[model samples]
Target: MVDASGRQARGEPQGELAGRLRALQELSGLGVRALARDTGLSSSSLSRYLNGQTVPPWPAVVALCRVVRRDPRPLRPLWERASNPLPAPPKSSRQGRPLPRNDLPRDVPDFTGRAEQLAAVFAAVESHRVVSVDGMAGVGKTCLAVHAAHRLAADFPDGQLYVDLHGFTEGRPPLDADSALRALLAALDVPSERVPQDGLEQLAACWRAELARRRVVVVLDNAADAEQVRPLLPGAGPSVALVTSRNRLLGLDEVPPVSLDVLSPEESAELLVRASGDPGGPEGRLARDPESAAEVLRRCGHLPLALRLAGARLRHRPGWTVGVLVERLAAGASEFDTAFAMSVRQLGRPQARLFRLLGLLPGASFDEYVVAALADLPVRDVRAMLEELLDAHLVQQPTADRYRLHDLVHQHARRASAEQDPAAERERALGRVLDYYVHAAAAADAAMPFLSPGAPPTAGRPPAELPPFADKNAAFAWLTAEYGNLMAAFETAAAVGADTHVYELPRFLRAYFARRCGTTHLNVLFERSLAAAERLGDPVRLAEAHSDLGFARYNAGRLAEAAAGYEAAGLRVAQAGDARVAAELALRRGYLSWDAGGVEEPLDLFRLAGKLYEEAGCPAGAAHAAAAEAWATLQLGHREEAARRPGRCWTSRTPTPPGRPR
Candidate 1:
């Protein structure tokens, strides 16, 4: 309610506070999306806050106030009251609630023959509230799990959630338990501020608490092992979980295991008939060519993935008889090979070449841009070819616009590429891929400038084009999504003795690691990059590697080792005479000194850092160094001098002293 003064009445604090926030946003003259972009918030969440549906977090309120140049301290009491409002009625008493979330992938229309396994899955979920479906690759573990989830969707009306743990994927590491839990919680529409940023147990507890209130079915697909999936299970509720893995999760003793095998010969034949849309009974192609049909089935090993691919080939080429398919399979050395070979042979040369080169891709899954880089083709051309490959069943689109090879298909592509493409050509293609990642990562890093903004030197040919990142969030999203592939690229570079790439690539990941990942992996990457830098015999690069290693060590709390790395960097950087690197080294050394309890030395080093940064023409670095110096002065009991400093210091950003990189 508003008074004659057009101000909120004394009561209704939530409404008053929301009105103030809305007024602040109006003052800023930005639309909802623009304000959200400026405030680092999702528009949906911001909308809720402005409409009084939810209390904005303190930081969010502060961000909003900052955008409008208003003092937020005046609003603290009202915010606190709004945030601590009376508890609402229980879920049982709530009315007109939203429908449950459903993220399950579409069920295969021709999902054939897993009757006994499907029954076992339902029974296990009923009894144990969890089921682990384990089998060999391409035996339809994921298919059966997804199918079962779709079938049980009505029973678990709370929601259906799905997550791929990326276990047994060719190049990507399995998703860790913490990340998996966060994904689960996010799918439940939990606010980002509510999710714990650290601690596996805390995240798991939060997930359990949320699940306890509702009946949801979660599919933890492509899990690496029991340990990875253990924390993702619901504790006590109508909610249940289904896990699928290539290896049997023997460690999940409480969860019943349903092991799948290749389809039986009869089932396989039926699947082929269904997949190929062949007429049933004595007049069908299989009935006319029994011997060849058996050969096709044998070649497929009755594996669902292989069978589907083989069946697709036959379906697409109606003129070809079973005997002709068998003749194509004869060229392959193995049963599995025959199935894949037949499908691959149907592709046009460019599509076929792209298929073969996809085997050389280092990541488990990739988007079209990366594929374009790998195949040295236009993205439009790659998209068309990918469609062709998709139809051939040579590639699997696990998600929209992202593709991967079935393990069997991956092996076949590798073999075929090796036999056909020359070694030099393969290396060149991989080099192009590495170059694309380096430039892309550099571009992303540029969007989100870290303490040291020096670009890493690219060693391979740059791609014809690169992906665009519009803002820090866009850059961060790209980094998070491509982290696994970037790691794989680094490893591939090291394997091929691409020392320059090995040394340069990890430099781009420092900011990402500090945010999403911790220092352990960062330390490992810098360690490897340091070795690469040494191999390349470039003093400036070596200094950068050492400085980066020191930063990682410092973040990981290895102060002594960090000092050693800084010392090494200092020596090498002096010899190279790069002003930017020298500035970085000085700033890092200042941080090291401050961290090690040296008062005067740190202040001196900070001053030197400030001077070098000015020389390097980096105002951000200079300001950071100046702030460090001011903070150190305050530590030395020179409060007046520290207060007189021109720039504001962000000492509260870190728990420790003023030693963190800018």
Candidate 2:
């Protein structure tokens, strides 16, 4: 390809790179002709180099690498390619070629259990070219990330790299995000650690420069948070990143949430059967009983670690049946916790304490509540707790105000509680919640008497010193404000065997009915209240609840059901011989029959109910009944007949046309 001028006279070197070499000679103080003279090359050949016609050979390259003091190894490939570009390979088998021997660790173990999660991670690898797999510890977040990165080998030609951030591990001081960034920069084949000491910006620019178009995948395992991941991002979308953490990394506002729940019953069993290798013999019939499998899964809380442990136990003791394992698990109340303990035992003491304290809180799905409750100190006091746990992926803060532990984490939390606190401390932690609810309820109940107009506030200090809601209106206000929360507390107390709350809580909430909070809300939860009252055998509470339920049902328009419920209440009331309540329920039942109107004797029933209400001195009931009769009479196309009940018909409040008291 040489020309008569001893250069590429006929079509040789293409563009920019050729120009750069010529600039290199001028800048390095090697005047083109003098450069040729020093290397014993022709002027014309040197001119061609300067004019960007032909790239010079190795003698020139050695000269260049020496002047720059950089490892010329990087530019060598570019130089050789320009000298003679390799023919583009044919399209027949183009995929997953390894990086040129320097991109990753010697071996990355295959990660199992979280297949769907791994698949999603891989899909992110495939689609985003940049992905972060974030979740809590023993949720197998990292394992899934590793597998996803490996699966995406085809996506990235530049290869995969891994780093353990040690964010959650005890005593293993976490590298500042910048230090981690430096390590990543070095991994990308950047020669100098002269990476920026301050901003990760320069290093990230270098990373993009290094990985640009190379298509690498970086598994930023155990990341601290977004500030950590953001600086490390190559920005070259061709590169994929999967981050693993206990923190929700809500810090990365852009990434969609890929929440990892404890495995489902079926998923857990598949893990067990696959990991333990068959519940033994003939299509593993032992594994096929879904109930037993579900029980086995439940014992493990369907978490991966416990499932893996159960599977491992079975694998070692091949003769054990699924039922035997389930029993062992059922007996080990800390079984899931035991499984996570194995993972945590690998951690240092400080981390273990943090992990344990995280378990001793009042509720599942916690937040700052967890920080204060478990650590038994302010979130401010436990300086790096969130970061530490986040790195380990032990605590998952998937959203604002929402933090979840993997079921495995809950298991670990139980274990953590036993180790971190004495039984008394654990009880104390639980007692705070109990006492808070009890006192709060006492306050609300003390306020309840005020809800009914003109009902002088119940005094005498409640015999329990329950706080006053200032006055009666305050009681109703408190009840109204805390209705849902109070109900939730009541349910919790009831579940924990505090039957006093089970009986008394509903009475306090009876005023809740006025809000018309909707039948759906009642239908969902109040049936449990009725069942609790019945189980406790409280006739008074039961009668009141049934009456309230009947009224609720009637108001909500399940008329026949309401009538049945009121009749049930009435039977109980009549037996107790509470004449006023008995009379009211009786009127309500008769009115239900009249309004329903399938019977021909509706007028008779209404008149009788009206008389009963009047005898009981409930003008509201009498007025309601009178209104019903007039409405029914009008419905029968007898408006003239409807004018008959004047004395009973809010007569003190209305005048009649015919003046008939009939």
Q: Highest lDDT, which number?
A: 1
Q: What lDDT does each candidate get? A: 0.82, 0.56
* TM-score of candidate 1 versus the correct structure, residues matched by position: 0.76
Off by over 4 Å in 1: 1-105, 153-216, 222-239, 279-284, 287-291, 449-452, 591-603, 627-662
Compose the digit string of candidate 2's lDDT tens values, residues 397-443: 64444455654566557666776678886665554444444455555
Per-residue CA lDDT of model 1 for 216-244, tens digit only, reads: 99999989888998899999878999999
Off by over 4 Å in 2: 1-119, 170-173, 197-199, 279-285, 288-292, 331-335, 340-662
Which candidate has the top score in TM-score?
Answer: 1
Give lDDT: candidate 1, residue 496: 86
